[model samples]
Target: MTTMTRAELGALGEQLAVDHLTGQGWAILARNWRCRYGELDVIATDPGTRTVVFVEVKTRSGDGFGGLAYAVPPEKVRRLRRLAGAWLVGQQSHWDEVRLDVIGVRIGRCRIPEITHLQGVG
Candidate 1:
């Protein structure tokens, strides 16, 4: 088997997250949605709940740093909120519940990646 490099692994983690969200019945609205404030990795809509989810993807190969979720700070959340608003405007989405979700992808040593979904990071 071909060992995935850093970038490839990171990309795989992100794609897995998108697919995971899709499996959860979320309609993917945008990927890498950007604004002046910051970028939202994935913007998905839950038609059943009428909610918009702004996703931040954090991929890690090891616990070298604190943790993957640590990358998403409060300021980052604020920035994501702004970008989420812009996305909403573009999509004309009137959502009752706007949430921030952090997907932490942990690549263990010779193991399948693990996904942790933390909602309302703010």
Candidate 2:
């Protein structure tokens, strides 16, 4: 068994998120996209709906603090929306719709990693 650091865990979660999104037919556009506002974990375009999705991934060892979904607060969602707007301003192409998504990753001892995706969060 091996112990994972916080950074390692976060990276793993983000990678898992990207893989999951790709599996769902989303084309990854960016990862860790940063700006003066904040950072977006994963940005993708949905092939089926032609929607631009701004994904926020939250990884945790357990629910010691709170459930994975609860990690992303209302203010965070608002900020993500702002980030999405900024990202859109820089994009060359257009999307039919813009959505805010949240991917919650939970890692616990002796348990498989749990991933939950909440689309159109805010």
| Best by the lDDT measure | 2
lDDT of 1 by residue, 30-64 (tens): 88777776668888887678788888888787777
TM-score for predicted model 1 compared with the true structure: 0.84
Scored against the true structure, residue 23 in model 2 reaches a CA lDDT of 90
Model 2 worst lDDT window (10 residues): 62-71
What TM-score would each prediction reach against the true structure?
0.84, 0.92
Q: List the candidate 2 regions with Cα displacement exceeding 4 Å.
A: none
Global CA lDDT of candidate 2, please?
Answer: 0.88
Rate residue 121 of model 1 by lDDT. Answer: 85
List per-prediction Cα lDDT, in the order shown.
Answer: 0.82, 0.88
lDDT of 2 by residue, 3-74 (tens): 899999999989988988899888999999999998989999989897999999988777787665677889
